[model samples]
Target: MSTVHHLDPEQGSLGSQGSVDLPVDCGQARLLELGYKQELTRRLGPMTSFSLSLSAMCFFSFFGGLPTAYVYGGPVAAVWGWVAASLANILVGLSMAEIASSYPVAGGPYFWCLELTRNNKKYTLIAWITGWLNVLGQFATTGTLGYITVKHLGVMWMLANGHVFSNAETFLAYAICLLLAGLVSSVPAKRIQQFAVFSAITLVFGGIIIMILLPLCAPKLQPATWVFSSFFAWEKEEQGIPTDAWLFLLGMLASQLVFIGFESPSQFAEETRKADRTVPKAILWSIIACGILGGALVLVLLFCIQDRDNLLTGEAQGYAAAQIFYDVFKGRFGNGAGGIVLLAIPLLSFFNATVISMGTNARMLWSFSRDRGVPLYKVWVVVSKRTATPLNATWAMTALAFFLGLPILFSPSTFLAMGSISFAGLYISYTVPIALRMVMGKSFPQGPFKLGMPQPVINVGAIIYMIVSVIVMLLPTQLPVDSNNMNYTCVTVGAVMILVMGAWYLPYWGAKNWYIPKRHLQPADLPKPPARTLRAKHGGASNGASPSGSRAASVKTMPSTGSLPRVPSLDSQASPPYPSVRHPLHRSTSDDGSEMSVYQPRLQLPDIWKQPTPPRLQRREEPERLPVLREAPGKGPMVPPHD
Candidate 1:
């Protein structure tokens, strides 16, 4: 029933004059319970949040990378590998949902880490590292999405025209794609949400269309046994790795990549309505949707393969899915019809993926900068007045992604190496907070939406899965790794870790002062106004006055209690009626040069933690009094004024 007054940052004021009532629900109340006030507009409902997360994951885009699994471990790796990775990722999503419910902030993992660590210095350091790592991961993911979209475009071009595009042309295309995605991200939040929803619908129906059309059009199809039961065994000499088992494990990267960005909902927590409940549901549901849809797509693609040797060694040597599309539709229908479908569906999905990725990156950067977690925090934290979005962070991230993608022009291997760090960085960032939560054990505060009794077990499993994923990502993809084909993900990850750690220790960085203030972690640090006061001040109709009336403008008086209501602590177990602390009496020189003892009330932890309520005022029942008319000096007396 409480009215929430949203802050207009650009105008440096609270509420809009003559604005309608905006109820403050438990979700927003939880945000206030934390240190931050609601800055971003909560326009995203549960469906929009789910669509955003699903778009970021972009399972349909996973088709672009399916060839990696096929090459590494053949049919079984591409099929079953997806199933295994999806299950592990579900665990990760669940663990993050539990934390996201407790601390539903745009700061995401960083804020959760701060809450989990409390005031402990060592754990605080861990929280700082988590924030930087998360920022890096987001940047890397953005770059990767941009790279993939551009790569897909280049492949599509080669497929249509029968010519391989050079790396320079691909880089130019990458820049253009990044620009387009940036533009999409800079739109208003509602528009962005709409775009996400549209993209998700297109992806789902497009996937279904592909699933149906490919199976129906194929002149010859692989037998059920080959599609579901058969495993394409590989000799040690034929695989990239030394052993078949290692190769299969390496092939799991394809599925792992699809699940990498499922944490997108948590990053958009501030923008999502009813974030505590909605965000967790979105996270869990998106994973389930992606797993089911992605698994089906993989199975369809696998079954529709009519010629394995042609897919692996012929004109479609590197791109099997593209080959399947060309062979199935083009062979049955006309070449033009098949080409149109290929460009329309998967290519469009890639474009949507890039835009969503860029948006996610901007949000993470803005959240991090809001806490002074990044250098040049002032510039990045500026939200646009026009779009009500983080335009600066959006463009900055686009520029960073552009630069990160520049290495592609030099060598595809180098670009792949750098881009691969995103997978490792994201998993590592996810692991840290979950690990801390497990360490905190019973002391950790459970949010409204939680895993109940199985949280600890799930946390342990998620940590283990993340650790394995990180290791797999770091391992070299090819045997006898040389400069040309070596995986530099480990080197990149190590360098980033060193840089972040070194910056924290360096005096010039001043991380100790700005990283994460201990006060921000305390619930009492932020105190909200009473519900009635907020309604009146914000000009809400619920206050029983016209929004523009003088009654709405006038401030209501509180009872003469001589003390303010206590602010509530996050700990529900804390007893009510918190006691106040008194400061020691200090002797001060008075104006007459006499010493006087001055005493002041101090805010103790318990006092600040207590929940505050508005004091009820009794209405006066006396009859209205008439105003007395005053006569001007040396003039006739005036008539009395009526009440």
Candidate 2:
């Protein structure tokens, strides 16, 4: 059934001093390869497809913080702020797309830093700092989401009945949300992808349905005069702020919070299939579409607001757009049924955000762990054999997400305030790696994707965003710095605090435990040897090289002893040593017009040993020459060589 060959002991041998055994594959070597392939599969397609794009839109829609922006800069600034942010968002997306194309790994900004850094000692310290800052940034985003989730649910409950949730009710709601979010993300990576796809689809359509149904169902709709120009027009002087200053700075700063997640997809690039292409596409599509949709929906609602006083002054007044929609529905459609449906529209988005957010967070945590940045390297870096998901990272993020949500019970604004602080921190965090990319002249490994833009164009885009982000981060949330000012100091302090945490990785701690810088292992780089089986007794190869058909007739066999070719073949003759199949790229030793194994383009080891030795039997020292026999007896054992 199969070809079998036996060793000839008299022919030749491997000839070694110690025992030789076949190499084995085990441990992280196996784990690394398995994880690499699994992550590749994840990046192949968008988990949420178009819906993820919509969630991005919905996020900015309810930035209730805009009122604070309005309180500081007036309505004129708020309108123009959206314009600046939209353009800035596109630039930010492109810069990140470039980074994703290069590194295309889960480590995101930090990994990019690791690759681009010139000096390991200095750049590594910087990259490590950026890594944990990213971790904090994730926590900040989760807190922000928690605040929004609680705020909206609270508003819905109030509108349904006429009461706010008591202290106990508030804690229970946050606890429930945290637990549910954790459990959902704790599932497998593929499962998360599928769920994200479904969530993205639902949220995108939900917004579309709301936009269509709202204007159609409203009894007294505004004419074109009121809808566009008038709604966008604002009286800046009434708000006591310079229109130019307000529009340029206040609006730009506030809008950054909503656009924060535009680069979220990049965190999963390593897990993405064809990341260079898919990640950049997903990011650009999400930002452009979401930016347009968010601006349009807010403007549409601005047209429909009948009473500005009631809109901004209600007990739960920050959510004027949502409340206005609900009020209109109740007044025109029926007894509160239509209004409930409208409220449910955005709420559905939170559901999608809940799952996707956890997925992103878990991926970031997993990437950090793989680099040994986290405390538990072996356990945290492990991917679940069954699910191929980072189970430990998921569990850890879940615990952290719950703890972060705890502040909500003490102060309603705690989570919200923390998010505002975190938003700036994240923007600052984003700028560092991007600045590094621009300063350091390097690129990531090429995959199926690349930013179609010229390098200079991409660099300029990154630079503009960096300048704007810094300017915006410095703006006061509640301007005029009175006792009631929003204390923008928190953002600055938080960012500084995050950087300070890097001190642990300074000379004493990081240097001691950190060995030489290790490159992330790729599949092709693993240790591998020629697939040859040793003969049982002779120790020579069992199946000596075979001529692969076309050159078989011209191939000459040679006795093996780990040495170079004994003699060269003449013209028209075949080469010896069975036409070596090893080291295909290397030139064949044959000097004659003899046939050899088809010369492969790739390089390989030559069949001849670099270091040769005498055969095992010949290695024994020869005995001194013995005396000659019979004829020499008379001379009483004369030396043998005389003849």
Best by lDDT: 1
Instruction: Give candidate 2's TM-score.
Output: 0.72
Candidate 2 overall lDDT versus native: 0.56
Question: What is the Å distance of residue 442 in model 1 from its true position?
Answer: 1.9
Candidate 2 structure quality by residue, lDDT tens digits, 208-324: 776677676666665655433332214344434455554447555656667766666777665554455667778888888777766766555555555556766754456765666
lDDT of each candidate versus the true structure: 0.74, 0.56
Off by over 4 Å in 1: 1-23, 239-242, 334-340, 510-514, 518-643
Q: For model 2, what is the error of residue 454's alpha carbon versus the real structure, in angstroms, after optimal superposition?
A: 4.0
Top model by TM-score, which number?
1
